[model samples]
Target: MTDHLGSCLCGTVKFEVHGQFDSFYLCHCEWCQKDTGSAYAANLFSQSAKLAWIAGVDAVTSFTLPGTRHSKSFCKLCGSALPSIQVAGLLVVPAGCLDIEITMLPTAHIFTSSKAAWGQGLRDVPEFGGLPH
Candidate 1:
């Protein structure tokens, strides 16, 4: 198990997580794209219970996706997106937010049916129709 540290772009927010991640995932859902303003979002899957806010949790703002059960956090000052915890308490930490290099290859590409045609093709990773069980 490795301890990972991450912070928002503005350095106003930071967090740490420890233990083996369940997996890494590429989320291609519309909500992910809309929230991240990217073709997809790469995240590390881990238990939210192990996460610790090292600094500025108060500086993070959250917004729930309309008509959905998911939400995202971001730096209030710089609008830099933060990782999110889904309904089941699975923390999804953005790959870009990490201060260290993560060698964990993504385990799944989720929401394939909703993915953009020109977006990075799943190619080799396991593809899930939606959130995997």
Candidate 2:
């Protein structure tokens, strides 16, 4: 099992996820897009893994979509996404919240029917390491 360290954007919340992720998904569901404010939400899923809060656990807050199983946890201060324990023994970790580099690639793209049109076919767009001049 591998251990990954992560923190909130304001560094108010810190945690470690211990064990291998069973799968990684890039979800284009409208809910995911709304929560992440992006074209898709990248998440790692695990059933056998565990979460340990290293600091500021009290700063973590979660919200579940009304009448749905969808839920998200984030830092109360910075509002950055954090790890969450979903129902049915599933653990979810946002891919971008980790402090260390991850080698695991996404297993699939889900809810593609809700995908945004403006986000498509961007592979041919210009690439830059930073803001363009």
* Predictions in order: lDDT: 0.83, 0.96
Candidate 2: Cα lDDT at 3 = 96
Cα lDDT for residue 38, model 1?
84
Query: Candidate 1 residues 44-118, lDDT tens each?
Result: 888733777899999988898679787888899888878777777788788889898898899999888888877
The TM-score of predicted model 2 comes to 0.98
Off by more than 4 A, model 1: 120-133
Question: For this target, which candidate reaches the highest lDDT against the unseen true structure?
Answer: 2
**Tens digit of per-residue lDDT, candidate 2, span 1-93:** 799999999999999999999999999999999999999999999999999999999999999999999999999999999999999889999
User: Where's the lowest-lDDT run of ten residues in candidate 1?
Assistant: 116-125
- Model 1: colliding residue pairs: none
